[model samples]
Target: MEPAAKLDPITETALRSLHDIVVPAPVSWWPQTWGWAVVAALLVFAALLVTLRRIKRYRANAYRREALTLLEGVADKLRHPATRPDAIRELAEVLKRTALAAWPRDEVASLSGDGWVRFLDAHDEDRTGDTLERLLDDFEYHGAEIVAGLPSNVCSDLVIAARRWIEQHVSA
Candidate 1:
């Protein structure tokens, strides 16, 4: 191998005079323009609005959630033959109380029989008033002997209709 070449005195002096390249300062995290800051603020404002609307809606439906829980208890009672009649009565009461909670008392308190069922249908999105007719109108007030005469699916259908109404009824 050839021996390393020695740099001339003038070339060595020139090389030593060269310094490292200068690095620019890091870019700032703040926006470059006022318009970009305005856009960012608008986005944050819109997000806060959407979040507040969702929270308000959830709070407004607290009664529906409570009614659903009561319906579940009635459904459990409906499973037993002995409790079926009383459960039907309780289910009707639950519907009435739920309606009272969502609507004015003058509109819901005095309703009974067909009027009550009609009120329920008017509020229910599914219009399941027919399914709840007999249970709410007659059987709710009848003795255990009358309730025992109901078709086997009647209790379940009533429960389902009640659940649907509780979940989907519109408030006044």
Candidate 2:
């Protein structure tokens, strides 16, 4: 026996049409969305890199400025003839150590002989000329030489040379 419910031909056709229209095929937009997200992430990464480079440059400049100030102060002290040789020697050592800190300690600290001479020679401040190297070398070689008295003028000249070198080589 057939069930009492029977669909008319017109109703059957409409139901079939509605079923096809209402049921859509699945869509895949996940890949497109991920691509856009990746692009945004790259943009953020580039911005951070630029910012870090700028910060590094700023720190380098600051370090150079501080080093210059210290060099200038030492030069000013040297101008006073009353300053003792021991004091001047101490100042020179301070300058050398500061340079090492600015540059590489292993390279500068291990430097000696003519290599050291050339290093100082490259600066070429008249006051700093041969005398500065001699004083430094003497202290390194004889330690006792540090106690010897240094002329006020010599100390002043060394300071002048150091200032000139710092101004020329150090980053602004």
Candidate 3:
């Protein structure tokens, strides 16, 4: 190995005076301007409004949820010939109650026969009132005989119409 040569006094003095480079601090995550902060606040407020609207809508439809649960039981009963008559009556009652829940008592309570059918048809998006009319009009009075005479698909069609009415009826 060769011996190292020493620097001149002037060069050594200049080298000793030098220091390491200084780096600036990292950038902040917070908004740099008031406009950015305002935009962020508005976005948060819009999200909160959307969340609250969804919660209010869910709470308002509580009756529909309950009616749907009741309809499931009615559907189970309708599967058997013995229980079909009573289930039809209960199904009609559920539809009436659901209408009452979404509309004023005076408007829905007095409705029956054609008036009831019209009311159901008016609110139903699919206009399935005809399918429900036979069940509502006859099942209440004729009892088991009427249900016995009905085609097998009648009960299932009634159930589908009722479900559609409950789900799509407009609120007054």
Candidate 4:
């Protein structure tokens, strides 16, 4: 064979089999390395937001929670067969303390007699203030008498009214 006719072995193989350039398939976008971390971060952020909201709600109602607990204790005391005469006074003290808690201490701490009753009704949407005032008037006269000694219905009504006052107050 003429030297010029002798084919290079590599060139001969390339000529025997030929196809389009074999480009690798494009990289898939899914199954990313950082996806789980991103999801975990979002979940943590959402949990933080919910936790903050729960904490805020609990703090804002702390006074209401405390007042209700105190009222329940007073009611339990008044429910006994040999209840003390001072339960009325106790209820009055609870009301005053609740008022002081819900409002500026300076505003409610100095209130007395009718002024105190009026202050209570100031926040009362039901206008039970007059009745509460009458009850308070009776309180001064009625010291720690047993629940049976006084008009039981009236005393019970007073307790209910006091509950409403604490529950319905606009502020903490």
Specify the highest-TM-score model's number.
1
Q: Per-residue lDDT for 1-172 in model 2, tens only?
A: 9878989999989888774446667886555677888988999999999999999977766655666677666666555544444456556665566557566777678766677666656644443546667656663355434434456666666666555655555421
TM-score for candidate 1, please give it.
Answer: 0.91
TM-scores of all candidate predictions against the true structure: 0.91, 0.47, 0.89, 0.63
Clashes by residue pair, model 1 = none
> What clash pairs does model 2 have?
none
In terms of lDDT, model 3 sits at 0.88
**How much does candidate 4 score in TM-score?**
0.63
Task: Give candidate 1 misplaced runs (Cα > 4 Å).
Answer: 1-5, 149-152
Candidate 3 at 50: error in angstroms? Answer: 0.8
From the highest TM-score down, the ranking of the candidates is 1, 3, 4, 2
Candidate with better TM-score, 1 vs 4: 1
Candidate 3 C-alpha error for residue 155, in Å: 1.2
lDDT per residue for candidate 1 within 1-172, as digits (tens), equals 9999999999999999999999999999999999999999999999999999999999999999999999999998887888888898899999999999999999899999889888888888877688878777778888898786677688889899889888888888
Provide the overall lDDT of each model, using Cα atoms, as 2-decimal numbers: 0.89, 0.62, 0.88, 0.76
- Per-model clash counts, in order, read 0, 0, 0, 4
